[model samples]
Target: MTAHYFIGIKVEKSIRTKLTEWQNVLAKSMNYKDWTSEEDFHITLKFLGGCSDKTIDVYKNKLMNEEWPGAFRIAIGPAGYFGNPKQPRVFYADAEKPKELEVIKLEVEKIGSELGFQTEGRTYRPHVTLAKKNAEGMSPLALESYDLLLDESYSMLIDHFSIFRIHPQQNPKYEAIAHISLNKEE
Candidate 1:
């Protein structure tokens, strides 16, 4: 059976714990219904909607054969939202020094396109989605409050990327299908 898949950089466990703490604080004040589980916290490189096992294997092999980009550091700098503050739809943690992340994403996109996945037309914005609005709009006041809380920074070292299979409408939504180490000598 085909499953929806995406490529992402894993967040370290200590960082995940910190992020979860931040989410818990936000949950107490905001009405956002969907908070990403700590296990699923990652920086996405590409999203491949639905693909067969054969397709996933092909991509995995391609990634394994590709050159590794050396490891880099990333940090949570500030909180931000998609859409206007009055009606914010997504709440996210911005990455500090995202250049390396961008390079990885572009490579992932190129490989995905070569594999016949539709090219993403929108400009890539690298952020870890913290929560999503469910049924109600986030008040501007709440957004402002969260923005203030984001001043404290959280950073981590990135050494690998992975292909994850997502089970639609399922809790603990993502499963790592393949992992590719970065900065490794051949």
Candidate 2:
């Protein structure tokens, strides 16, 4: 049977904790039904929907053989929304995308396309999704004004990215199917 998969950078625990706290505060004011579990927080590189095991294995082998881009640091930035700011659909904490991150994303997209996965039409905007809009009538203006300030900026050294199988209806929904380490000696 085909399975759903995606590539992403796992957030470090300390950063996840800080993001969870921010989510709790926003939960009080935002009308969002789905709040991403802290353990599932990540910045997606590609969403590969459902595909055969043979296809997944091929992608996995390619990823393992590829030269890893060495570790890079990213800082969590301000809260933001996607779609219309007046009626936003996704609430997220932004990341400062350095050149390293963009290069990695580009590589993933190239590999995925080679494996017959459809190319992503939209430009990549890396963010850690916090919640999704639930209530139909709630105005995005209610969310845009809130300042989500942590005691300090959360930063992480991204050393690896993973292929995750999505369990759409299950708790702890994202299961790591493969982890490719970025330990290439520079």
Could you estimate the TM-score for every candidate? 0.89, 0.90
lDDT of 1 by residue, 1-186 (tens): 567899987778887787787777666556686889898888888889988999999999999888877887887746667876665678777776467777778888899999999988998887888888644645433554453556566878888999999976877799898999887533
Quality of model 1 by C-alpha lDDT = 0.79
Candidate 1: where is the Cα deviation over 4 Å?
Answer: 137-148
What's the residue-level lDDT of 113 in candidate 2? 92
Worst 10 residues of 1 by lDDT: 139-148
Candidate 1 Cα deviation (angstroms), residue 18: 1.5
Measured by lDDT, the strongest candidate is 2
Clashes of 1: 0
Pick by TM-score: which candidate is best?
A: 2
lDDT of 2 by residue, 1-186 (tens): 577999998888988988888877766656677889999999999999999888989999999898877888998756777876655688788887899889889889999999988999998899999888655544333654554363236778988999999988888899999999997547
For candidate 2, give the lDDT: 0.82
